[model samples]
Target chain A: MPVVGMVGGGQLARMTAAAAVGLGATFRVLAESANESAALVTHDVAIGSHLSLPDIAAFAAECDVITFDHEHVPGAILAELESAGVLVRPGSAALGYTQNKLAMRERLSSLGVPCPRFAPVVSVADVEKFAAGSWPVVLKAVRGGYDGKGVWVCDSAVEAAEVISHGIPLLAEEFVPFRRELAALVAMSPSGQGAAYPVVQTIQVDGICREVIAPAPGLDPDLAIEAEAMALGIAAQLGVTGLLAVELFETRAGGLLANELAMRPHNSGHWTIEGAVTSQFEQHLRAVLDLPLGSCVPAGTFTVMANLLGGTDPDVFDRYIHVMAADPTVKVHFYGKEVRQGRKIGHVTIVGGPGDSVESLRDRARRAASYLRWGTEDGE
Target chain B: MPVVGMVGGGQLARMTAAAAVGLGATFRVLAESANESAALVTHDVAIGSHLSLPDIAAFAAECDVITFDHEHVPGAILAELESAGVLVRPGSAALGYTQNKLAMRERLSSLGVPCPRFAPVVSVADVEKFAAGSWPVVLKAVRGGYDGKGVWVCDSAVEAAEVISHGIPLLAEEFVPFRRELAALVAMSPSGQGAAYPVVQTIQVDGICREVIAPAPGLDPDLAIEAEAMALGIAAQLGVTGLLAVELFETRAGGLLANELAMRPHNSGHWTIEGAVTSQFEQHLRAVLDLPLGSCVPAGTFTVMANLLGGTDPDVFDRYIHVMAADPTVKVHFYGKEVRQGRKIGHVTIVGGPGDSVESLRDRARRAASYLRWGTEDGE
Candidate 1:
């Protein structure tokens, strides 16, 4: 058995700890506080900051391999750990690109991977030049941006100047009009064994992922195969040892363009916990431990996962029983976090059976999540 | 979220803790040592003995409801807790029947449940009279027996006398020519809600369960329904609030006979972790907490579970990688315990998909378990 140390203690780490128990692996999480989600469940936890090199080095000393729950650790810290002979899955070289969006776009573009046209932004002049072809342009912080944060859609140079005055490193990109968002999740081991889950269509509300449908309903089989290949190829090209989730934009032209790269388990793959033969959490562990990857075959016809964002209700457990009673087949997962308005509290998954339609499964999942969040079938 | 306290820290509690995390429930286990299976994984563990009244009382103080990982707690201690107004699922009165074999048999017989002919054995004459119509009768200890221990087969009066000479409480039963052993697992909530899993055929060697095949291949559908109904009826009649595992002997006469009773999560239901829509561990948590029970539908066509008992190899993990690589679809669950010859260390499960035969699935599961246990596919 291997001791897997994760760098962050969010829900991803919490779910990964559950998977580690089944695999007979000793899991340790380096969390920021004792009350963090993973810290509450796993026995072996080190309370520390991921940004502190000394804190991470001390935690990594007791583990066979170190991974991440979120891509927030500075690349320099991971590089230092690697220099100290610590086994860091998805090593510093690979994580560098994910930490900086400008670097990721440059690397993918150089590798001939389809992506949005982009340029580094030092001033409003750079943004104006980049937006020459389009009126509205997407300005993204070069680092530390997640869930719609640190991003602004500028309609003109005046708006761009306002965002640029914040004095944060930024990048400019073409605002591609896309039909929907799709995510291709792939896991690769150090031994070069790779496995890819089905591409899923993700629905985002205000830039936060709200729902996901596996196999991206009505997707061309050829396109799904191509997407999987592209993700696996990216993992191999980037020398990634764990999970790499490539969020893509399905353009109206029926082409796929990579939108973002997440070097750990992403929200779009949460449905795989019940929909796929092997969960992403378990696969990530196997990858980091250099063990054989489990099969990524879908377990059912369709699986719909709905994110349970906190609504007006702070105490959602009162509504939990109601949702459980209303649907016996829907699976609920909760992160041990205090609920706040619009915060991601948990998720609901519904796997479609033999005669079940994708629409029906989505509706069931949505209803359960909505009830748990707002105490209503429909989010009012 | 509610705090769930399990009295014993075995593999059952370890798996239950995994489920508890998914439901956002706080789980605590009382273990004799820090290295117990459940204690190793769960953070909130109390180093105490179930036999110690004071220790149990302290553990119960932190829990909203108390449950058992095994039926080894003394009835008197649980009774004391109940008198103190502590909430104990499968209250002492119901657990008493599971603790004493003679009492369980008598109560089932009185309830018109089909069972083997049996009587208390105060002397050799009782065994002789009970075996008048048969030879090689089964002698069982009335309490504290598991996995072939505290059980004996008496060929004549002399052997019966030798077992009785030990002076432990004993019971005599007629030898049954059973076709095969089947287990019906049912869960009931304090609210009187009941859910039954598919009947599974259990293969045993020397009274130790080795493998379980869900739905009892080739079993009559009507008989499966009858077995489920009978088990549910028994749970209600006995006032069992958590889980009741009814072990049955399908006699050569095509009738089911009650064999044994377990009021906690039993080995026979381990397959439900991956086979059923709702795992037995999760169901037990929901039942004891009086939350709505999840559906018990099979997740696939068929599922086979093979126990991984330690063989001559003291380090079974040396062979684990081989098993994981050989079959990616087979799910392995290890109970973090030291490997001792013939001791249950883990289990392997394979869920059959379309075009898969029950035999093929069984072979895959058995091969994985055997390889991990003995470093050979055939257990040579």
Candidate 2:
């Protein structure tokens, strides 16, 4: 059996390990701690940091291919692994675009892909120059930011200057006033076959994804197709051999612009676990291993996913019985993590049939998530 | 978190471990060997024999609730665990019925449940007397029979006399010329809440389950309800706390008769993995932990599951890429076992939408399984 080594031992890796079991493949996770989600489930786990070259090399030595649960690995380490002949899906070259915001913007721009105007910032002057054409710009750290961290929206150059003082390499982009954010997820194999999941409307709060609705609810079919095509195009152009999530902004002016790129299973595709014929985690495994991708057809007419953010109560098991009894059809997934307010602990997914509406499914999922998070049935 | 200790570490235990992860619960397995299916995946594994009382007692001490993957454990051992105040789902009293065929027949018959006429047999004379009423009788060991093992079909006293010389405890059952074998699966929590999966038609080969069709094609709606009611009745009467599989015979007379009983997850319910909202594995976890049972609603119009029996090819991973590419909608489940002739290595499940016929779904699933088993696309 071919061994797949995942760089991060988070929930994504944990789910992927479960998927790999079905394929009878060896799945190894490199974890910083023994208690990490994936490390707890998988038998072949190497306790190591993703940043340590020796640790990564040792883990890679046992693996036929190296993939990732998160895109936090340093590009240099991935490049080094590539040079040493270790197969890394979404190779260092493609991962470079996801590792640094400026690199992604430059590459996408060069490909004539729909993207917001962006500029690398050495100082506030760089932001000011970009702001001359579009005000209220978004400032982001070039690397190492997740779940709303290292991102700032500034209305003035003064705010941009204050952010620049943080000393992190920065990039400024024209902040599109979007009606809603959408994510297009696609999986590609080294053989060049691609599978696209339905475009989903991602609900973000404080720049963190809170919920997602497959097929984008009432979005035009043509737009969904266009978004899927764009994501497929990005995966093909980047030579990405795994799941590619293109987060797009649905501009108020009736156009879509790519906001970010994630080269692994993304949170926006979580609903696919129960709602689609094939899950993103399984597809990722198949793609990285250069196997054929599974069908991306939705199993239900409407599917909704709501993140189970940690709340006041820490004991989630106590609430599980109540949540399960309340909504018999809802699927609840919990990441083995201690509860802390606002942390992504787990999620709930619900699928509605053809006769059911998206709003009803969303409400059911949110209610289930609320019950799991805070033990409330009313979803407060 | 409640730690569930499963006595046998087979595929049932392996899948339950995966389900326990979703519930944020800890799962432990006691396997006779380190290479057992569940032992390979679960983090907490105790290498011990199920027959060892000391080993089971030590394993039970670490578990909040103890369950079983197989019913091979002795009744005295389970009774001992109960006496020790260790929580055991489907307590020893109920498990006794599944462990001994004569006991099951007596109990169900006393309950006025529909069951095939059966009697204990000490010699060929007893079998001859039973055969006097029913010509063709099915002879089975009172204990320790599985997958066609320890079973015989006696057409006359001469045949029964030859089998009696083996000196194993025996029982003779009236052989029903049935239309097909069907299974009704139910999960019940300690609180008495119960959920039932759709009745399924099980195709058996040499007494081993080969394929299962959910919703039992051509089954009368009233008969399906009756079978579910009977299964639920058995669960309640027997005090089965986790999964209860009631194997039935649809007789030529158009009524159902209970054929066998399983206290744990059974091969017949494997279709629920992709066909039902809550899989049997997950439902078992929820029920054993005294949590609310999840819904057993079907996910699609129909579903077919076919077992992947090991064949000439031992390299399953080598064929996975081809199998997945050939049928994108088929969900394959591998048991992580070395292939051997006639051994159940894995299974494949495929769901059909409203527009698809059950015949088509079964064909697709069978083709996928054949390809997986023989490494031939044409299923030759």
lDDT of all the models against the reference?
Answer: 0.92, 0.89
Give a tens-digit lDDT track for model 2, residues B19-97: 7777777889999999998887777899999999999999999999999999989999999989989998879999999
lDDT of 2 by residue, A93-124 (tens): 99999988898898999988999888889888
CAPRI quality level assigned to candidate 2 from its DockQ score: medium
Native-contact fraction for each model?
Answer: 0.81, 0.71
Over A1-380, each residue of candidate 1 has an lDDT whose tens digit, in order, gives 87999999999999999999899999999999999989999889999999999999999999999999998898889999999999999999999988899999999998889999999998999998888857799999999899999888899999999999999999999998999999999999999999999999999888899999997999988889889999999999999999999999999999999999998988999988888889999999999998899999888899999999988868888899999899999999999999988999899999888899998998899899889888899982
Give the best candidate by DockQ.
Answer: 1
**lDDT for residue B183 in candidate 2, whole number 0-100:** 97
Q: iRMS for model 2? A: 1.3
lDDT of 1 by residue, B89-138 (tens): 98999999988999999999999999988889889888988888578899
Provide the lDDT at B61 for model 1. Answer: 98
Model 2 RMSD in Å is 1.3
